[model samples]
Structure formats: structure tokens, C-alpha cells
Target: MNKSTYKNQIKIITNKNQKEIRIDKFLKNYIQNISRNQIQKWTTSGKILVNKNIVKKNYKIKPLDFVEIEISIPSVLDHLEYKNITAEKINLDILYEDEDVLVVNKPAGMVVHPGFGNETGTLIHGIKYHLTNSNLNNFNLYRCGLVHRLDKDTSGLLVFAKNEYSQKHLFQQFYSRTIQRKYIALIWGNLIEEKGTITGFIGRDPKNRKKMTILKQENQEFNKGKFSVTHYKVLERFKYLTYVSCNIKTGKTHQIRAHFKHLGHPLFHDSIYGGNRIFMKKKCSNQNIEFLNTCLKILQRQALHAISLSFIHPRNGKCHFLCPIPEDFKTVLENCRNMFLQ
Candidate 1:
């Protein structure tokens, strides 16, 4: 990858309406190449500087604020790339770095690994391009230094082990459910209770086998599902929306999305779980109904983020880390500031 491509920016002329808006949002609308989630991560890690200050991604902009952003593309991924592999040199936000591990904030749209339609430019490929041949065991399915995997659309703090011992120790901790994984999500409706926990058996939905579901009492007895647990507290409420902090004890497939759905309060953009479709419907008024079918494709993913992760350093026994909140989620959360006063 070319190191020279890492340093750059374009003038974002903002009018009065957007003068005080967050920096992360501006990039998403102006820079088509990058996603909002990526900008959010960079903001949290102090990668995206405004006038050379390490401002929070949620910092409101002033009129004519000259924003100078320095995004370092992942470096020297010699092992992850070959003669034919095309890896996009996208910038990754490194929260904390050391010889033993790297805590990075992953973006919402990035697929974690190569798959059916996304064989190129995945998080795995990005890692390989930046830190070639990471300390990963052959048995680790997600590869690279990835000890654990996050859903492609969920943005937030993820750990990457720099060596074999750290990888194994972190892996075992996650397997035993010792690591704390917390998330912030905006779901439809004002969740009445302040905080609570949700526990149930989760299995593949028989009708739509691709998705996971919380089995009912009758089906739980003989279910092939795993036990799932989530603890959450409502942060604030929008008109018909609620921002919540979700802590997962057992990381099953689609646990956050499915569990919230089972609560009758699916995430705002989770279309499969009966999330708001009219929001997209209103955004696509000019198109024909046939074209409209896929017109709202951009809004299919939910607004969720991984904000914090705390765990013991398996090898060193240090209190490892707690990653900051991604900016996009902050932007969404900031929208509910009025809710607290009301």
C-alpha cells in the first residue's frame, strides 16, 4: 500500500444550517469513498483532528471551522495481499497499540472477513495489509489477529492480538464469557423501563433459517439454541425512538438484533425485524414503486455501535482497556439530548 495516499483532505464549505454539526457527519456526506462509521471511529481515537485539535467526534462545528483530518491507512500488509488480491487501503482507527495487542474501532459497513460478495477489502484483508501474518492460530476461524468477530454492520471497539499468547488468552476469556462487551443502539419506541435484562434460548428461526430467534417456552425445552443474556438501560428517548446501552453476557449470533426484536422494540433500521420502513420510504419519494423496492437499501442497516470493552489481559493480568464511543452513535445519541430535559 502507498503510504503517501494516507495524508489528505478536501475543503468542506458549510452553510449556516450545518455550521455547528458534528465533524463525522460532514465527512460521510462529502466523502463518498468513506463511511460514517469509519469517521466516527477516527474521531474517537483522535485520528480526525479539527484544526489540529483532538476533538470528540460529537464536537459541534463552528461556522467556517477549517477541519484538517489525518487518516493513516493500514500499513505494510505484505502477507494479506498477493499478486491478484485487491485490498482497498481504507483508514483504520487504532484505539490503543502495543507489541501484544491492538484495540481498534471497526466500522458499520465493513465485512469482517472475505465472503460471497465481499471477497476484497474486508477487515481481515485490511489487517493483513497493515500487519501481515498476524499472530493467529490456524484453528481461529476469523484469522489475522482477530480473536473474536463482530457482525459486519455493528460498529465499535474490537481487540486484535499482536502475538500468539495474547491471542489465546483473550480467546479463552471470551469463550468463558469473562470479557465485557457493551453496545449502544437506537431502537424504535420509548423503552419505558430504565434498565433490565433479557435471557432466553436463541436458535435459528425455523421459518427463516438465516436469522436467529428467541424460542418460546414450549420450543425452549428441545431447542438446539444457545443461552443468550443481555443487560440494558435506556439512556434517553426520542419521540418514538430510544437509545439504549446493551451489555451481552453470551455472544450468540445476532443476539442484540434478535433479542431487541423479541422485546417488540427492534432497531431503527433493522428491516427484517419490522423496523421503521417509512423513514426510508419518505427518503425515496421521487423513485418508482418498482425501483423503490431497493431504493431504501441504504437504510437497511441499524444504528448500533460497540462503545466499551473491558477485560483482563489474560497473559499479563492487566485491566486491559475500555474503548470510547464511536461518533455516529454519538451523533444519534446527541439527537436525544432534548429528551432528558423533557
Candidate 2:
């Protein structure tokens, strides 16, 4: 048993007598707490290395091969986090619900799930209470039926599966990119093209793990990140801002936000991406600046919303959902229109 553990890392060396086996399968057997899906994701993200070289999840272990895994506590013990989450009676803005699926309009400012500082009053907590009160106790509570997530400040459609079968089915659809999702955002600058597609690999910013960045080329670490494509068309144009509808081709973390930022047009009021600041002209009027500030004050977070989502149901054949932009988002847009059109 040549295995050792260090700070947030696991090291294992296959002995001469060890037989060949797929890395993911081997890791699942050896590590009791982790999942095979997480192993595969870590392998793809260059977090798992064999002989100090990144390899695919299926790479068979050779005798004397060295394996190193960089483990993050949050991701590795997500199940524990879910279990620790207490179900609070938070009201949910449910758009649709059935025996197998629950689609909700997750409001902006609400955390999708419990995390470091956001352990209570999350969407998952609300859902848990809803399910318990509804008397649907048999459903899996490990993740509270959550199949996907939305950013804390990005409002919109999110779907949860009620059973294991539906969860697996929906997971496959999301993994295969068969799920259709569209977002509408008010971004910082006017777009040069009315419609365009931004294609790049999205990875965590090396300097800032809190944010995602568009990788210019396939590097050792960036190669582990998923390739993303965002298709955008101008919905409306304001004086210095643009309203756009974006159809995402890939569901990478912060795909739309990072992609547009890579193009120098971050979503308006996205403080994390530098959209909260003013992009000004030398002769900009005081009225314009004051108006922009008012608008910003109206919408304190990123002006991005998942406007629509469509997917083939595991049981019902086809399902499509659309979420109207939240009040703050709507009001901000209206203010922009009045100011710009004048």
C-alpha cells in the first residue's frame, strides 16, 4: 500500500504486483468518498496526474506509475455539504413542476446551493423544504435533485430532477450539450456586429480563481478547461450600452460572462468582470454619468439573465421553459431606453 496524503493532495504509486486498470475506475475503488464523475472531471482539468503527466480518465495504470490528485475540499465533499444544509421554508418561484422534474425561476441574489458563506436560504434549501412538505420523501436528497446551477447574481431558469432516473437522464442531456439555453444581457459597450459568435476555451484565471477567463490557446492547464461558444445578437442598442440575446453552444462555467468580457464587453454592472465602472468619453455629460449611476444603483449586480431553456424530457418527451427578466433587470433596461432614445 504505497499511498500518502498531504495538504489537499493524494499520492499513490502502483506496486509491481498491481494490475492494469482504468484510472477513473481504479480511483473510484480506492477512494471511498469520491465519485467517478468527479475523478473524470479532475483528470480532464489537469488536477489528476499520472507520472506527473496529465492523462485521460481511461488511462490504465502501469506498475510503478505515480498518481497525484489535487483535491479541493468543497468539490470533493459536496455530498457532505448538501447533507449539512438544513431545509428552510424559503419560498420558491416555481415555473413548472411535475413528478420527475422541477423547473424554477431562480431569482438574482439567491445562491443556487449552500457553500462557504452561503449555507442557508439557498435555492436548494427551499427546494428541499418544498419536497418535504409536498410529501415526496423518496427522491434523492444528496444534491436535492439539482441537475444544474446558476451564478449567485445571475437570475434565471434552473431545472432539478425528482428521481435518480431523471437525474441521470438530464445529466446526460447537459453533458452532451443537447440542452438549449439562451441568455439576455445588457453589456458595457455597443457591439460592432449585430450578431457574432465568440469561441474560446474558458479556464479559471490563474491570478484570480474567483473568476473565469478566456484562454487564448491550449496550454497545459487551460487545455483542461472546456471549449465554449457563445452566439450573440443585438436586441437593442443604447447610447453606450448594448442589450444582446446570447445562445450558448457550450455550458462552461461563466461561459457567457467570460466570453463577452474577452471581447471587451463585459455584462453591465458585472463588478467581478469590471463592468460596474464607467466606460467614458472625454466630453461625457454630467447628466449621462448621473443617469448611468442611477441605473447601476437600480441593478446592483450583473445584468445577465438566463431567458430561456429547452430540453427533451426523460419522461415527457419535450420540455421548454422561458423566464421573464426580473424586475430590476427590466427597470434598468427601461431606464436605458428612455435616456438613450431621448
Candidate 3:
């Protein structure tokens, strides 16, 4: 294998011991941060060649074959289907910005990236529009430098890398669990302890593919789920609900919601995990039920907010950010105090 000093192109020569393989699949394995589909696209565009000849994506290479791939630094947007994601004039609450990174306070109910139902008006679309028209726009930016993400309904501070170097650095910190992240949540029922940790293996539910659940003891041995841990502390207690702060040791899909639900205290208004309805504690008066219903009306989504985030910058030193709870979350807590504490 020979790579140019600037990494603008890559040339690979198959050895005698090398087995025949499809060019697209081989390149996908050889390249970093590139997908097979992107390789196919490059092949179609005559960017990838075999023996100095244009080839199809399905072309198989035998031993002693010579392959070359052109690296398009400025054309990185094509890999993300940038044209398909329309940039919109959306308001972005930027907390911090530098040559290497951009931190923004993402609001609740806003999708981070485009998906099936959410094709436009996403955070990425807004970021594209914001950067493309600004001086910060650069050729090395990939996927708007998104390293991590929050659920659509969860509001929090999110950091974006402005270049590939910063993106990989941030990703390493998150994977190593060195990044400190804390979330505040309102959950149904009171806790027996002031602080505790929930440990379990979490995976997708077989019956409901859209939802995640903690695997039972029998399924855990089979490695059907990823090990997850959530440490929580009671911040305030109501008659039938508890305000808590959660520090997750492992970042997984729906980890906080699934762990709390497994602990018999699902997050309040978490409809999927069964915390939306009124959870009766002993005999409740009709007035109390009505009051609980009012709180639910105030907070329609799960009561979860990423309050604190801290991490070491790739180029700079340590960076920390804090985002206060949204209005709906605050209103629900105030109403809980007024009715239960009073």
C-alpha cells in the first residue's frame, strides 16, 4: 500500500496470498470513516480505478491487482447527501464556537439529524445553512461535525466538531466515559434511598422493535444487550413523584429511561415506558388525581433534561457547559411543589 504525503490518493497492490474480493467491499474495509455506499458512488463517478481502468462497483480483484482511489477533501459533503438535506433559516442557540468546535443548546422536540419522517428542518440542516453562509464554512467539515446526539424530545448542550480531527477527539472522550454528563429528570414514585445506581444489560425489545428494554437474567448471558449503568440522586421529592439527577456511566439508547423503568420508577410523562398516566399510591382523592393530570398536561414529553456536560477539548483545555431546564419542565416542577408541598 502507498499513500501520498498529503493523503489525496491511495494506491493498493494485492499480494499473491490475497484472496479475490469485490473492489467496493475491499475499499470500505481499507478506508476509515467511509461507507461501502460511498465507495460505490465514487466508482460510478470514476473516482476509483482498477489497474488504471474505470471499473464497476461489483468488479472483483484477483491477486496482483492494482487499485487506486481518489480522496476528495472538498467533496466530503457528497458522502452525507448534502444536497438532499435542505438548509433552513432556523434559530440556533450557540453556546460556544471556535475554529475546532461548535457547542449549541439544542431545544426539545427538534430532531438532531434528518430521518424518515423528519426530512428537513433538522439541526444539521440549520447548521449547514448557518456555516455555509458564514466564514466558518470549510472543506474538511463532515456531517456538520456531529460526534454525539440527544433524543428528539430531550433538550441539552451538544458539542459539534468543526473538523474531522476534533470529531475523532470528542468521539474518543465519549467512548472512554471520560466526559462528565448529568441529566435532571422527574420520575414517578419516591425512592427508598437518596442516591443509587441502576445496572443492567439493555437491548431492543423483541416484541416492540421501536422500544428498548433491560434484558432479563436469562438473556443477559447470551450477550443480547449492552451493559448499562445509571447513577441517580434524589434532588426533590413530591407526594407521588421524585426529581432526580442522573449521571450515566454508559451511554446507550434510552439508557436512563430504561434503567429507571427497570427500577420501578419510570420517568414522568415517558409514555413509552409507562410513566405518562397517573400512578396511584394508596387511595388518592379525586382532587389529587386532577392535580396530577394538570402536571401531565404541562409536561407532555418525558421529564428529562441534560443539565451539565463537561469534556476535555481536543485543541484547548477542559471545557464545561450547563443548560437550565426548559420552561415546561420548570412549570411542572413548580406545580408539583405548589400542590404537594403546600
Candidate 4:
């Protein structure tokens, strides 16, 4: 669920002046980071439709015609050989575990899975070690029963399925928006509203491929990014910082971070979104600057922790999982409070 669900759908309404183009070529130009081969595969598999009817890859587009492309893209693990992932022994903060699921408190700075430049020392490697050593046959070697993901720098509760059936069931809950996820974050500025919702279309930043941005109306014309929503409530407010609770309505990449940033209050220490720098200060003095630097060092990452997660157990349907904030995050909050009090 860490990956955005909107990547599956590509909808377009042809402009009045739109020229006739092959459906595959049109899609390749419409969607960013998508290849023509992938578009053809989706078309051939009947995942592409024109005006509500399935179309061939070479189908010609027409003005005022509607096109909807549905893609069932495979997970990253599907492309990697299971044997390539080494099960490294690492200590995991187990929150809860059962025959069908496992809940763990993932620490900050831990990658959820191995990918391109990161091929080891990830949560997946540790999970593999734990499951294999425990002699559990429930997890697949590739995904290790993980159905969702957290960013490398985010710390908090994470749930993992124990089997294929449980994985599908849990994934469906996330896809359907039945799973509840609440995160605690210390942001850079005081929000004007105590509680509010942010709604925008989230897409990869054209300037920076590694970052996500809230698309403006003019920007949405061609990109048509996924719609994302997040609700936030202020818990405590300081002169320069605000503690808030964020509940995500859509699990897009960097949803919470991007939403908060769009509100002019990025999560504290979020270097990627420009929160690592000081946005507020009691006074422009060397002491204030030193204090802010110290706080940055203490946080080291985005000040976001997945404090709560509630989802029905895929097996029994009666089980729910929850976890408290981790110590590191709490310590940072306490330190910030003390600094403000002084």
C-alpha cells in the first residue's frame, strides 16, 4: 500500500482539437515513466478500453473520445529472483505476531525492501531470517509476506501477511480504503487551521524524478496524476513548530509529506521536501540557529511516525493491530517541547 493505487488507472478525455493517434503511442505520451512495451501489453491483455470498449494496441484515437487504461502491474519482487535476496540476521522490534500476520515497529533509517542501489540490510532481509529461523512456511521468498511498505526514513507500525491468501486479503483492505493508518508528525510551521483536509493530484515532479508534487490545474492537463487526500489535526502548537496527526485517505507515494508541504508546512527534518531547513524561529540569533541545528541532528529524518494502524485480520476477521509511537520520535518531541519551554 505504500505505492500509490492510482498508478493503475489512466483516464483521458480527448480534446476537440486532438489529432488521430495510435492508442499505444497516445498512452506513451500521456503517462510519465511508462514504456510503450508496457502500454502494448496492457492493450493486448484487454486492459485498455476506448469509449468503454476494449481496443487493440493499434487502435486509432478520435477527438472527443474517452479512453481508460487499466494496468495490473506486477510487484517489484516479481522481477527479481528470490535467490538473490540474502536472509540477513537482524533484530526486529516485534509488536505482535500470529499464524497469519505479523506486526513490527520498524525503526527509522531502515529500508523496507531491497532495490537497485540497496540490496541488503533491509526489513525484508530481516523478516526472511526471522521466518526461516522460526521454520514458518507461510512467507514467500520474494516478498516475505510483505503487502505494504514504509519509506526508508519513516519509523512505525507495519503489518505483514503470513501467507498468500492473507496478503491478498490485507491488500484488498488497503485498496478499498478500509485499513486505517494514523501518523504523528512534527511539522515546520503552525497551521492556520486546527484540523482540515488536503485534496490534490499527486504526481512525480517533472523537475525531480525522485520527488512528488501537488499538480496545479494547468499542470494536470497533460499529466493527470493520481488524486490524493490527507486529513490533519493539530495536537500541540509551539512558537515555531506544530505537532499534528495525519490520516491518509489515499496511500500515494509521499502523500503525507507532499500534502503537508503543499500547505506550507513540511514535516520537520524532511530533507527531500525542504523541511530540513529552519522555517520559523523565535529570534534570528546564533543561539536559535544552533538550537535548530541540534534539533535537526536529533531528528535526522522526517518527523513522521506511523503511530496507529487498524485493519481486520484477513483470516479470522476479528483481529486488529495497533502500536504506539517509538522512543526516538517521542524523544524528539520531548526535546522540542523542552527547547520551546526554555
Candidate 5:
């Protein structure tokens, strides 16, 4: 490949012609922070080859069979450094905390981390500020104490990285796709199904950086996002709305909202995808309009909440955690019910 087209290449050598090392395993030894899937992609795309022959990722290494591959990825150096991260002791609702982890109830309208247009006053920034000059700093900046994240508009439980060891292990759980995350949401339709799953490929819209699209051609570039899935159960159905409890199997940006919207339903009060007067009026009684107005006043963002989170502790080998619903969400539900009563 042209030097301008490819970044770096690696050649693999082995002792004897052996079915010993799976092609992907042989690759991990050489590449740091790279996954087996990447190697397989390289193989499929003609980037990784054995003895100058294109092979599947399962190809075993032979004594003199050479493996050549090219890969390009951004360096961690491109990420923000710890020193540059100033912590702020912003009002964090610490639901659970210990020597190893911290679970906090994050409110809506709060960015979990500074990204996009949001540059400061994020959860990470605040945690960094609070943990400054403490044992937490012993770890890296990107993971001072965060395992996963909720969207800026989605309120609920978030586990933070308190140290480096926990950070790595926790991240491993998320990457391995084993983390259990559940959300509660008020949606704009009367969903008849009690439980079901939504699956789609989610990627950023080239036309709008702020949005993601589920439909894209196979083998497309970065514009094509990852496979996302959400399993949802209708907890309660209001006149024109439904409350859904969702367990996210694959966490992607706006997975719940996007999936529901794809099926002709968006979350309540969702500005981007939600219908304004249409859905809002469906659930509202004559009096619901007044109550919804009050609910809207308290709800700064979307009507979604991460009410629960459970995962195995990466260290001690035990199951752990459930964060309660935020007061604002509870208030919305209560008020929504009260509106229906009227």
C-alpha cells in the first residue's frame, strides 16, 4: 500500500508450521490497544495477509509464513492529559461510593463529559476537580473514575473510575459488551407490545454531525456506526404515551431514542425527533396540558432516565449496584399520572 494510503505494517514469524496461534491472537501480541475484529477487517480488506496470500482471521501461523498488515489509529496522546483536566466540585449526587467506585445520579441537561460544543462543567471535569490531589489521580486522566456514560439529556446512574485498576477492568466489561444498563423512558405512543428488542446500525449523519442514522450501506466508512440493540418493555401506557423499561445490550449514542423513532415513536419532549403538539397532546388530558407545562418546566431535557445499573466487580468477583430514579423523572411521572386523573 502507498505510504500515504497506509500507516504501518507488521510481519509475523513463528517457530514451526503450527496451528498454534490464531491469526488474531498473533496480532494482539504486536499491536497494543487493538482488537481482533480490527485484524479480521484488515484480513478481509486485503490489509492482513499470510505468506502473501489473503487469509481469514482463523489462519494459523506456520514456521516461516509471514503475516503482513497495515493499521492506522489515533494515538492516546491525542486525548486530553490529566494535568490539563481541572476538577470542579460541582454538586454531584453521590448515590454510592467506596474506595474503588463511585455511583452518581446525574441530572438531565448535564453533559457526562465535555464533547461536541460542550467544553466544560462536565461530570468528568467535576470529578477530576473533586478528586484532585487524591489517590484517584494515581490512574490516567481519561479514566480517573468513569466506566460508562449516559447522554447529556438522559439522566441516571453512572459509575465512575476511582483508580486505574478499576478503570481498566470496568472498561473491559463495557468493551466486552457485558455491562448491564437499563433505562426508563416516557415515549410518545401507546405501545401494545409488552416487551421487544430494537436492533440497528447507528452512525453519524454526514449531513448533520449532531444526528445519527440507522440506515447505511454495508462496509461503509466511519460514517457507518456500530450495531446497537435495545430491549424494551411497556411498563405503563398512558392515554397517548407509554412508559418503557429498556435494557441496552449494545450501547450506542441515542440508541433508545433513535430505535424508537425508527419504529415511529420518539421519547416525550424530545426536540430533535419528537413531534411537538402531536405526541404531547396525545397523552395530555384537557388538564394534562397544564400539568405537562409544569412537568416541562422541571424537565430541562429528554424524559429518559437510567434508573438501574448492575455489573460484576472487575476486582473482587461480586455483583454490584442499582441507582435510584432521579427526582425530576419521578416528578414527571407523578405529574403525568395526576394529569391523567384530571
Candidate 6:
């Protein structure tokens, strides 16, 4: 409710054809990078108004309806005060940079942000150091303008805004699923179908807090998890493994891992989701087993990489970015092709 905390104000006038749409649904379609749950919460909290009156989530929007949304931006000072994270100098593979934004190729094994066990030497710390050391001025110091993140050990392109306005703009893109992300993953089994889609709710495992799991909506409590969808297309098939490209429609914690594990074909070498062991049983000589073990040693981590990312530039709304696969990932693919695909 604080006027000073408001970051952005959106105003919309519905067309004649938009009648009968729910207010929450209308807001979600009109605004980029906002979730329906978030819209409902805003509606409940009186942040959304129709013709100067607060509306409910299910209110049917009328033709020519006047809708206004006030978005509250979290304060950087509060974030800094609560977290004991500090900036440290580190190497970074910056792919692109501009006055308003930055695109970096985050290497595998590097944590994106600081956390309890990983309090330093993260991508955030590296970004902060890069910004402070460069000529860029008047940027948000906390979190160094990170709009989104990649899990540790998943290498790929990541975007960071240079200021608060760009941050909010980029965040909206992610929320509305306007940003395009594609990942290449080598999995344990030959997919029966060349292309498929996986749909399930993702939530933390009740028994193992360290891992994420696919939830059965009928068995779980209300609001226990978020709905997630992933589309995959097989690129190449080996004797016992398949190389597939995945495009996630929803960003959930370990969504791809959990969904693939649910499908019984976890990522190659993904120990957390049971991809580390050999899944297929076959009669093989000792030499063949040793060769397989050698391949596993070379491909040590999960055979997944964020190979592509595309999003509209917040400031100019023109520029797009795409990053190439890293050497390690390429090397693993080559090893798989030479050793198993042959």
C-alpha cells in the first residue's frame, strides 16, 4: 500500500471482444511476466482496481473496462540487510553487455546466487565485481541485477538487468513465459517416441527436502506445488541412451530432472535423479564395461546444458541473444557418439 514502494503502474482498456474474461485472467494476458497466482494475490491485497474500485479474482471483465495494476518492488536494502552475502572478484564468461542489460554464459558447477552453503564466489558476486569495476554506474548493488537464475551444475546463458527498471521488465518476461529457453540433455534410454510433452506439478519431496519431486495433485494438499510442463524432441539415439532437446514451459525447481525421472529416463550422469548408474542390462565383456565406465568418468556431471535463450530487450525491445554450447558439453556428446552410438 506504500506509494513509495510501487515500482510500475499498468493501465489497460479492454476491447469489446474481451468481455466475459475473468479479471485475473485478463490481467495475466494483458501483462507480460506475471503469474495468475500473483494476480490473484494482488487482487486480494487490493493492488488491482477496476474503474477505481478494487475487484475480486473471479470478477468478469466487461467491455471497455478500465484496469489498473500497481506492482510493488522489493527494496534492495532489505535484501542486503537480511543476507550475509558479499561480492567477490571472479572470472566470468560475459556473452553480451549493454547499458541496460548483460548476458553471461554461466559455466557448469558455478552457483548462480549465494545461499547458505554457497555464500561467496557465485555468479552474483562475479556480476557485482564486474559492475563495480566497470564504468557502469547507478546500478542496484544487491544481487547485481539478476533477473533469473540457472541451477548449479547446469551451464548456460543468463541475463541480468543493469538497473531496477530493466530488472522489473526482464522479470515480467520470465513470469509470462515470453522468454524462450532450450536445453540439450543426454538421457539414459532410447525414447519410444521422437517427441513428447510432460505435464506434472513440481514440489519439494516431503521426505527429502534436498530433492524435488513430481507431485500427484489428487494426493497432495492445496497449493502444494506449481504446475509444470516440458516438451522434448529426440535429436539422436544411441544403443542405450538418447540425446534430446528440452524446452520447459514453466520454470520449476528441477522440473526437467523430476519429470524425466518420472518417465523412467533420467539424464545421463544425473546422480540426484538416478541417472548415474547404468539403466540397461546387457551381456558385455569386461573390456566393454571398462569402456562404459571410462565414458562415465569423462561425462562426470549431468549431461544437460542451457544451449539457447531468446528474449526481447527491455530497453530497446529489439535485441535478441543466443549462446553456443560449452566445450565440456560438446565433448560429452562427442564421446557418447564415438563410444556408444557407433
Best by lDDT: 2
Candidate 4 colliding pairs: none
Q: Which stretches of candidate 2 lie over 4 Å from their true place?
A: 1-81, 136-144, 218-220, 281-283
Q: How much lDDT does each candidate structure score?
A: 0.66, 0.80, 0.79, 0.78, 0.70, 0.76
Q: 115-223 in candidate 1: lDDT tens per residue?
A: 7998887876676566654343342222226756688878888888765456656655664467888888888766778999987777788788877899875774323
Model 3 lDDT tens row, 227-292: 677899999999789999999877788989889988899989898989998876456688888888
Clashing pairs in 2: none
Per-prediction TM-score, please? 0.63, 0.76, 0.75, 0.76, 0.73, 0.80
Mind giving the per-residue lDDT tens digits that candidate 5 earns over 231-328? Answer: 99988766766888999887777888788888788887777765333464654576657665666677656778988888767666756566777777
| Residue 127 lDDT in candidate 6 | 78
Put down candidate 6 lDDT per residue, 1-342, tens digits, no spaces. 111232667677777766586787666545534578998999999998999999888999998888888886553333332135565789998989977888999988999877889887898888777887888667545533676678898888888877656766776666557788898998987789999999765678877887788877575531356667899999998767788999988778888888899899998888898888876746555665676577678878888888888888876776666777777668777876887666
Pairwise lDDT winner, candidates 1 and 3:
3
RMSD of each: 20.4, 9.9, 10.8, 6.4, 8.9, 5.3
Query: Where does model 3 exceed 4 Å of error?
Result: 1-83, 137-139, 220-222
Task: Indicate the residue-level lDDT of 142 in model 5.
Answer: 51
The stretch of ten residues in a row with the least summed lDDT in candidate 4 is 1-10
Write candidate 2's Cα lDDT for 123-211 as tens digits.
98898888877865566555336767789999999998776567656765654467899999999877999999997667788879889
- Please list all clashing residue pairs in model 6, or write none if there are none: 33-172, 33-176
Which ranges of candidate 6 are over 4 A from the true structure? 1-41, 44-84, 140-144, 282-288
- The better-scoring model by TM-score among 1 and 5 is 5
**Residues 1-342 of candidate 4: C-alpha lDDT, one tens digit per residue:** 232122345567888987797887666655544677888998888888899999888899999988887665454345335466788999999988877789998998899979888889999889888887876655555443676679999998899876555665676566556688899999987789999999877888888878888987587433446667788999988667899998987788898998898889999989999999998654547776787788788778999999888898976665555677766677778877887766
Residue 177 C-alpha lDDT in model 1: 62
The alpha-carbon lDDT assigned to residue 73 of candidate 6 equals: 55
